[model samples]
Target chain A: MKHKPRLPQGLLTTGSITLTVLVLFATLPGYASIYTVILLAAIFMYIVLTLSWSIFSGPTGYISLASAAFLGTGIYTSAIFGKMLPLPVVVGIGGLASFCLALLAGALTLRLKGIYFSMFTFGLVELIKHLMLWFEINLTGTRGRFVIVVDHITVYYVMLVLLALTILTAYAIRRSKFGLALQSIGEQEEAAAHTGVNVTLVKVSAFAISAFFVGATGAIMATRWTYIDPYIAFNYLFSFMPVLMAIFGGMGQLYGPIMGATVFAYLEEILITRFPYFYMLFFGIILIVSVLYLPNGLAGLIQGWQKRVWGARYVHP
Target chain B: MSILEAEGITKHFGGLTALSGIGFHVDQGEILGLIGPNGAGKTTLFGLISAALPPDRGVIRFKGEVITGLKPHQVCRRGVARTFQSVKVFPNMSVLANVMVGSFFGRPNTVSAAAAEGESVELLEFVGLSAFAAIPARDLTLANQKMLEVARALATAPELLLLDELMAGLNPTEIGLAMDLVTRIRDRGITVFMIEHVMKAIMCVCERIMVLHHGEKIAEGTPKEIAASKTVVEVYLGESAYA
Candidate 1:
């Protein structure tokens, strides 16, 4: 009999920690006050967005500003289908719609590398957002929809499930051969191609998979507002926040963005409450400092320290 | 018999001619050396053969099958593999994981995780990188990094291998070892088509050598014949010899 490959201690430790956190959050709704619950729900939405963005942008080294486009797709998909089908089915359709957009966008934009891809994606979102508005305006002479109200607890639970799914997908992809291919693409696209990675296919599929998570999350979270327009649905804030958080956490590791999201989320909460006028300035400063001094972000430091302790070098040149 | 054949292969980057009607073949299990001056299109030829870039003219046949326009990954799956002129190891991955990426190429029959590990370990050991397998690739010395590249290319289980500048920046000791590795690779039934600036490696290792000048083949012969050629001496050697 062949010996089973031993699981890395790091993976196991991280896995347990994640499970513990998920369980803790699952139970928090019961004991936490309504304000805390609402904040937690928002935080969890950020987590899903961060995870989803990281799924494509992290492993592939593609800076995507199109998360909002997928989010908008989900919002519209949910708005149209929420009353006709069950919540889960509506969310599923929203995810599929986002996947299609991702697939199309990936095919068109992934050929451009580095900043070109970033610019094209940013442009794509703007184009999509405007197209969505133009279509909405032409069809209804107005550009918003009334959504079916879901129970707050149910919405919270659904968001939890989405966060869990995003986490699972990220973990799975990071450890799989597919993730290897994507990582290779990120490191060196031409070399990766020569090394037998299907650069185009991997890039496109990663885009679709990343979009699937954000799409679902957006759809499920839509009921909280009960009315969403292209403005709110395709909010550029959703597009920028995750990219910054992923960068701030670290792009190389799966947990970097999560750490980034948590820290930034809490930091934002404090800053906005205490110094509302200067909060944006502080946020911009943090981003700039992290980009300049800590290019690998917080997780990079933690990973380096861990590696040094274990006698392995940090995984960057 | 020829394992790889390129005929009338031409490439141009805009108006600049990189390779013009370049044609050559690598025999089965032979260490064929390609020597050229800087910008002589030796690396470009490797790129064309490895399918990293498409030829603007002519066809390439690998294992007697037309593979002119195949993408690098597709060509790789068809039993052609290569190393880069500049080391392109996945710096963020573990040393073994870098090799594992190669092992996973071409529909590796490693159905189980253990089997995959075993295969990667074997390739790592072959390239003499087994001891540092747990370390990330970025930490390795320059020599070890080159060896890691060789191991990764070998992991593809290629029938034909294109090694670009494998001996570019190495000491005599490392060059000797690298030459031995190339010989061992050929002995194990892999055809090695290599580009080398090191005359010592070309003279000692290659069974046949082809010289390129300005993207065109200027000479092809045994090492002695190449060494004796008036054109080779004037164009490539130009009064330099290493003991």
Candidate 2:
């Protein structure tokens, strides 16, 4: 069979423009109220986290559960530096630290395949969290550190810019040689390797890229919250949430994570407001149903539906 | 000097010696045919040379470099590319996308999108798959899938191409087309080494033939020489079948 170019036009133009406008409006000074600003911040953070996770886990199927560990590393590294250094420097340090940590993780775990890799990553997160607790004296002075707040709007804008950058980077990687290599590995590792794709290097590169964004987002997140602790930084729920969002959005597609984050955030808000005790249960059910019926997630389901409709029309005409 | 050489290759699976002390060489741009019975270890030999399996003892030299235990990707980057006996194209991706994968990542450095696309299209055209470029690989027929596999390997721009039973499930017409394609590949200055069970295709296309029995090389020579070998006949027929 021959290759076909099937880029969606709507996604390239109208969808991107609308998203940019919406993000800009949300972060604009004196535009959204303080409460709305907080909500927007939460949504953006989730989107960034989900997109970062999708980079490695979605296309390559590595399924690293160590995202929160790297995120925490970034959060704490930036939080420590932010106390002493400038904000931009702190964010840079966070990205560097997270990237280093990802490299370490990749080196140790790249040899493992499938579920074993996932389990090892999950363990790494737990190990990092405990190590953070053990080294409390040096890291937190026996207590959690806090960054004094001076500019909420500045932080909001920083996040918006970072989110845009993450999306752009993801899009670039998707179309680049590295992206194709990673996708081939995800589809069939042995076959990809036989065809000359350096599987280990590709996986490691992906993990590092994922770490850079997750870490930057973590640094921003710590500043937005004005507090940092290993408990919240290495939260298992945070790691799992991004995976769910990626799966919900459409695994390897560019906008899947964003769509997933938007839906997930809204769902959490609605369910928590109406039935706080049962919200978790409701969320689980929704995820199960989405996976069962739309195994490719929302983006795939929608694409499949569109193809069917169009195919029927062509046949009938 | 031979373009590709294997020296003292051996592999063991627990107590089973899949291959023991096997060695051979292929001249540049030559179509070297390999034939063996089910347990003769032809696939294992391909795996060892291609770096899919590490040999217990052996040295593989491609273009005169010792590539004993390089990883599969490393071997490919060193100008050796291969296709699996079983069809292994990326099923979910479009046929064009599958070939583009080779052009994009087959070499170490990145190729431009236009260049990659052009190369991929040329490969598809060479393999007679230009018409199905936009279709998903899963939608292709068995024969076309095998052709696509060959196209993908070619996109890697390897100096030597290894094909594994590409004609196993192909019809006679498809087999003829594949043989023609193999000849064209050789005409383009890429050496070809293939494993095959179809005697007719091998005899028609191969410059020389290597025969294996019970993981050992029983004979190696031209089609006329290999056909008349006593050991080759013994391996093909059990003692009773030959009698």
Best by DockQ: 2
Model 2 pairs in collision: A2-B96, A2-B132, A2-B133, A2-B134, A3-B96, A3-B133
Worst 10 residues of 1 chain B by lDDT: B105-114
Interface RMSD of each: 2.5, 1.6
Worst 10 residues of 1 chain A by lDDT: A1-10
Q: Compose the digit string of candidate 1's lDDT tens values, residues A1-317.
A: 11224358866997799789889989988898887877777788888899899988887778899989898889888898999999999999989999999999899879998899889888877888889899989987887999999977888888888888888888878768888888888877887787777899999999999999889988888888899888888888989999888888987666788888888888898899999999999989988988998878999888778888876643433
Q: Residue A243's C-alpha lDDT in candidate 1?
A: 89
What are the runs in model 1 whose C-alpha is more than 4 Å off?
A: A1-20, A270-276, A285-296, A300-317, B106-111, B239-243
Calculate each model's fnat, 2 decimals.
0.70, 0.76
The digit string of per-residue lDDT tens for model 2 on B13-81 reads: 999999888999999989999998997999999998889999999888988899976888888877888
Tens digits of per-residue lDDT for model 2, A144-232: 76854537676777778778888888877886778888888887788888888888989998999989988887887787667767787
lDDT of 2 at B166: 92
